[model samples]
Target: MGVSIVDVAAQANVSTATVSRALRGLPRVSESTRAKVLATAQSLGYVASPSASGLASGRTRTVGVLVPFLDRWYFGHVIEGMDQVLRDNGYNLLLFSLGGYRHGKMRRFTESMVRKQIDALVVLTLGLSAEELRQLHRTDIPLLSVGGPVEGCSGVYIDDGAAATAAVEHLIALGHRRIGYLRAGIQDEKNFEVPALRTIAFETALAKAGLELRPAWCMVGDFTVAEGQRAAARIFDAPGEQPTAIFSGSDEMALGLIFEAQRRGIRIPAQLSVVGIDDHEFSASAGLTTVGQKPLEHGKTAAGMLLAELGGTPHSLRETLMPFELMVRDTTAPPPR
Candidate 1:
């Protein structure tokens, strides 16, 4: 045999258990003894088995991340942020997708697939119900949520309602009284819907400013570019009581609205002003005014919180709100007389 933990222990004049503990860098092992064991292990070319170490210590040094949808831009940015932070802290990520059915979500989570595999859990934009949360708590894994606040879980979230308020208020400040609100269609009504929050905020702001919240001005639909074009057509089809400003729930939808308006020979800001949430990658180049929330930072913060829980530091379980900024670009302005 080449070299083993036994050989390393013999060379270092320490117990095999001491050699094992030192190599794994587990707690309760003295620094001096660890240094000696590491030096001896290196000299003997002894490599510890990762699987055996994990099995013996009952720690996988991994975290489980559950997201509602992976294709969305915000979620992608959050995943990138979490990936970087987890790697920096010497932990691996195990991702789970809770797709389609509630039963499926429960089965996938409760099944042995992820059993004893992850030290902590982080859920992105998926608000867990009391029963679902209780089921998760049965795992005894620390949990965190992002995008929206959860009842009992430690979370990193943005004030999405407030961001929408800021975007609408900006357009109102530009003297655009006839405002239209575009929202996303509700897919998962039980989890969380941002458009509902945005709509409420938009209406609240308008009512606070003593402006009428018209039925004709409110439109709810998908976030697709095609939906944007369709909504724009519907809004401009009739000449009675036209809106001078539009507040879109997403940057992608805003872009579609902008292009559709241009096709109709409507001049942005001068003829029709537009405001959007999510300062997307092309928002600046497209000159789209938007509310900026750091999706990547949300991811990193959630990851950090999970790691802290895993390490037994026990951080606060309160909802942590990340900051938001307003990016005023060429898309919004005062309407013409």
Candidate 2:
């Protein structure tokens, strides 16, 4: 027998009506009681029907968002913007989160749910294999992307190479020739669009400026603040000389670098200059010099674009380039004389 609302209500010791309301995320349920009901339902393997939407007309009026991490600042803020738009348009968001980033996972995407569950799909900052993209295409619904490039997919993202180039140029213009870089991990290098383009621009900018590339100064990270701290330890502990400045790929990693640098009593810019991408909310207080872009706008813009297509306003543009700016602040300066 299928797990029904009656079964869930019995196990949760709540009325069947309560189970219905809680499962549908309706108001009037106490937070504690709602949580308990949700846990009980999950434990009982209860599946909710998409009966609320127009499933009969082959339209769910819900957008499916595939994200690598829901907790990360970038993804969270982007989802926030996307949610506001979707909600206002009488649509709901369906999220598929990986919980964390992992390297070399050979999981092929099966888009059967895409056909059954959503009217449109938004892929956020995660890479999709050609085969996976094909699977998604087979569903014949609109596919939109934010923050990363999926080949043959229409998307919106900042110009990564240009942004990285501007950041590197900021360091160079500040007269810091010996600049290091905190780069994305190997997995990002292999599949993701944002990190790979940024890395190329970083290297190209250094070369164009006639600066020497030092292998010892480059650090690989998963673009997290915690990983940035550990990478900093390796930087200071290396046997040879170190670069006077660093260009972190993201603001979160830069914050981590600054935290670790300050912990070791290294005076900002006086001892080490650090610049990062993304002017995260805390960037102002921390005084990080970075190339800033808005992830929120990326989300709102992409979601609106997708909805436009669904609303019979399709456009010919396959990709849109967003904007970025270099914000100079206390964390960077002219190299020590």
Top candidate (lDDT): 2
For candidate 1, lDDT tens digit of each residue in 1-337? 6787788888999887567556654444677987888787777777666463532344677878777666777888988898899999888888888763445546344534454566667777776666666667665556788777665776787788899999999998989889997777665434565666777899899999998877676665566567877777777775688899999888878888888899999999899999989888878899999998889988888887766655545453457989999999999989879
Kindly provide the TM-score of model 2 when superposed on the true structure, using C-alpha atoms: 0.82
Poorest stretch of ten by lDDT in candidate 2: 50-59
Which pairs clash in the backbone of model 2?
none
lDDT of each prediction vs. the true structure? 0.76, 0.81
Candidate 2, superposed: residue stretches over 4 Å from native: 1-57, 99-106
Count residue pairs with overlapping backbones in model 1: 0
Per-residue CA lDDT of candidate 2, range 53-161, in tens? 3111324668899887777788888898899999999889999765444534655566665545776778887787777778877655677788888766788888889
Off by over 4 Å in 1: 1-52, 100-113, 188-190
Q: Which pairs clash in model 1? A: none
**Best candidate (score: TM-score):** 2
Candidate 1 lDDT score relative to the true structure = 0.76
Candidate 2 residue 167 Cα shift, in angstroms, is 0.4
